[model samples]
Target: FGKENPLKANEWVRTFGATAGDPEGARLNLWAPAEARSAGGKSEIGYWGMELGRMLVESEQMPVCLINGAVGGTRIDQHQRNVADPEDVRTIYGRLLWRVRAAGLTHGIRAILWHQGENDQGADGPTGGFGYETYEKYFVSLAGDWKRDYPNVQRYYAFQIWPKSCAMGVNGSDNRLRDVQRRLPRLFSNLTVIATLGVKPPGGCHFPAAGYAQFAGYLHPLMRQQLYGHARTASEFPGLQRAYFVSQRRDEVVLEFDQPMQWSDSLMNQFFLAGQSGLVQSGAVEGNRVILKLREPAAGTSITYLDSARWNPENLLIGVNGLAALTFCDVPIDEQ
Candidate 1:
């Protein structure tokens, strides 16, 4: 395989296979099992993969293959392996490489879709919760190693860790992990962290079947914009750009977005200002911008939107495209 033989890696290009009822042409495998089920029936339906592949094939008018090597309840550490040890097939990372070789996909790996970190946030396990800094270290290392092994893979997409049902303190820690995920793009240019704010989890930590399908709905448009470059309008995927104080009084802080604002009254309620007084009040949206009215001078204040440690059924800072605005905190008001 590619691990033992460097020349074999070049053979991982597009290949064709013929199966029952399917023609002898290039086809994308929806998931590893082809059933789109995982984690003891607590995982997504792989609608995202199927829809993404469909978009690519239809838009480009070419055949493309999509494969999944994801396993539920696995921590980032479980996937982080020693790339130098080619014979070490102990981790999921090793198994992933083996699967790639088995599938004869050594030539190209366009992108990797990652949705993990829930298991890492748990309190009990060998790979239990860690600080954001530590989590970032592990994740960056993992991505770097994967890219090193699969040189054809240039882009990595990951879903932000969604809200979970945990103790208040644990929830806070999980939010920090989510923040780490959000900042991953800053660390790695090829990485894009998809927001999972509006998608509600069905029960413990898994998205419902409907949630998975809806998540695919959100991802498809993003892929169109980010990957295919079809939707060139900002209205397709609204995201926060910068936040700063617009007034010398420091009472009002303005939030700027990548797209035009479609402000709603309910979205205004989601904004919060944390100052020395703990939780300050917020104000209404004004013309594609959110104004935060602090109770006091915002010298040491931080503005956060949809920043909840626990599940909030009413968190509604959605973009015009129906995707939720990413949770963010901008402080040092004068520095903007």
Candidate 2:
């Protein structure tokens, strides 16, 4: 079995056979074998797969089987098969399909979990400092390919990439990548960007065991509400909807959000306004909106939450569901 012309589905099944099926009931394969170490280890020490499986069994009375297919240090391009060369079995995407076919789960895929993009943001990355537009194109193409192959797959969830820190000072382009990931949901309705706010990666870009466990905790409730049609039991996470200049107070700007925010002294500190002079100034949170005091006028000023440029450990803006406000910026005040 090699990267190129790897084993086919039938061949894999004939050799390894189906990974022992879940005797409890049905199974939900949790793919991502490549990055298993990052999510814990072979036993899934701190992987979210364990948490997901347990939640499904206890809360929803559903049996699940996690099938991992992730490979470490791989870029999105590696996981994608060439649309023109669909028959090529060299790509990781082709290999993943083989695994799915071997498991006889061509139609059992509930959701696809993606936690990648670090490699793409590397200094000498394949894309060479890929921007948001380019990243969007590649991702959309990948999602389209996956859907074309597995029509039964319901939703696709991706993690916003971890940023550069003192421990791992490799790629400084992570913020750009994170921005691209944050806006992916707008482009693809079926995709959900799992918020990685408040998650502190240990050293390097990978989250430690505890961090992985915490990520699972964040994901469980979301899946419970989104996939199972259960009502949100926790506080909602605040997200920006739009921003505009106050007609009466031209120097002031109002920011609207999708959900209400739990305002606090610390939370208000996370909000910032920027203009040509840089870091304009922030005001107060009045009801479900935030007011920004522009240095001069609302001409070229923009408001951002959690300073989308760098990793700030102190940034905290809790939303409705006990989740932190997403990293956002570049909200034009003139736009309604």
Candidate 3:
């Protein structure tokens, strides 16, 4: 409970089948940013509360409390009170969820989304500061606390403290923080830390409103696709060889298989064009599919697959058949 707009809870009615009220039998509490929580004042939750709300509505998932307890200058240490069980909580700072099972809030609270540490980035000690060893213990300690109370609860999605302006890895804060953050998934079977590694904007520790919106943009559409996209078998999302955003009209964005691509891991939202002017996002789906609609000629334009981070200079998707399905140029098929 740090300060300002603690939470902004709401109930997003499922669009299709479910009439009004909580869809799929879940009573998502939609915890609004703590400051706005006139009902409950717990604002130090972190922007994740806001982010989670956006994802729920965007992903069009079940009901959610979507609480926001972020304080302007708060750190992870502040979440101790939120821990579902006070007796179970054990961090020096004390930031965590109260054992809802013990407090008697809801029967099945799926999981908790913890995100913090912008403030503690510089605090010195064990795990790079909290004693590298202790840093590791904090995670187990926090999870153990929760597991003990909510016995059935397991899935956890915590943030690996964002890139710090504190020291950028010199004192090993960034590195150690990351090391500690990455260990969660390994330490706990149901735990996962959504990688914000390359997702952060330039000089931004937390995404601004615009940045936040874009992040939310994907959840809804992707969730909708998931309805039709979820595979019935183990081989649902097969590996595809290419990904990118098309930038030109008629730019044939062909996804060549690393090995024939019978199917893909997911209908890749791939398409990106990078050339003399760096890179830009591709446009909508076309006839059979949509390649980024090019407003300009592709004569000199260079198209890249996926994000700038996704690169294959050799175009491995090309295969022994050579750059067969590859579309390196925006050239029109000429019939002389």
Candidate 4:
């Protein structure tokens, strides 16, 4: 999401059909710090792809080809294919499909880095009534198409958008969309969601060069863990597994994570007791769980963390893999 001009070229990286003239999808030389340039270096350089590809090539000691068919400000529904001709070149989905087929990568794709939902979330662009349920439906359809099209695709890395700076007039919609994105892994076996809350330069809807580079940094290890079966710590997302009260003190709730995690003390106010007057007064990291001390009793109240669409925290609760916790909304608390 950064870079006005192309950077140095990486010989190990290549692109297929970045221009209209290249119908055969020739493997053209790409220019960037570590990524294949989109539109033959005529478009903005996405550092995430560039750096991630560089890491992959360095780790595997082989060349990697990137086929990017992303259209900016497109809704998830726009990516849906026409059933009559799924690969119709006139449509967005078809164009991507056409490129994949033309490049002979219909069965060779290792992973898909899905970073979208700005427009669909009613933030940066028109939503057209694309709400939570509609998004889930369209995403499911798209995933189905991918499953059928890219039969060999191993990983589906979904990026959960940071709604704070992105929200325009629809804060609820933004948060809901993010929640849906965070829950995508539960819907698909190969899908994993990456949190974007911790990325730096979080001023505008699009991040700066360093932010996109951080995105790549977060993705590389996870990709290695999934694609190469490498056991890398901090590669796994520190997602919330459950929330419950550990003892008779109804003022405190324990958030259990899926993996061991670490946190900064500055995020006490980030946790919210839904419908409750006071915020989380304090928090402690213990092994894989976090104990949040609330100003009021949290009984019968739902819990949320970093869920506000306009709240951007400088500090984050990161996992062993250096990834932040996926933002959650209205996560019900259980009495344990």
Candidate 3 residue runs with Cα over 4 Å from true position: 1-9, 13-48, 54-61, 68-103, 123-133, 165-170, 200-203, 214-336
Candidate 2 regions off by >4 Å? 1-46, 84-89, 165-173, 200-204, 234-236, 248-250, 266-282, 308-311
Native-referenced Cα lDDT, model 1: 0.57
Q: On residues 1-336, what C-alpha lDDT tens digit does candidate 4 reach at each position?
A: 333434556877766544333333322332323343445433223566777778889997888876666777667877887999986666777766776786677999878889888777663323546455578888899888888999998889898887643554264667667778888888898898988777776645777777888888888888778888788655766788889987777888999999878767777767777734346788788899898887766556577776554355566778876767888877788877
Model 3 scores a C-alpha lDDT of: 0.38
The count of residue-pair clashes in candidate 2 stands at: 14
Look at candidate 2 and tell me the lDDT of residue 44.
28
Tell me the spans in candidate 1 whose CA falls farther than 4 Å from its real position: 1-33, 38-47, 58-61, 84-87, 122-129, 165-171, 200-204, 229-237, 275-282, 286-288, 309-311, 329-336
Q: Which candidate number has the best lDDT?
A: 4
For model 4, what is the C-alpha lDDT against the true structure? 0.72
Candidate 4 residue-wise lDDT at 189: 86
For residues 223-294, what per-residue lDDT tens digits would candidate 3 score against the true structure?
A: 334332433322111123334333335343433333333222221333334433322233333222333334
lDDT of each: 0.57, 0.58, 0.38, 0.72
Name the best candidate (by TM-score): 4
Candidate 1: residue 25 lDDT (0-100): 16
Candidate 4 matches the true fold with a TM-score of 0.86
Please, what are the lDDT tens digits per residue for candidate 2 over residues 64-91?
Answer: 5555556667667677776666534555
Decide which is better by TM-score, 1 or 4.
4
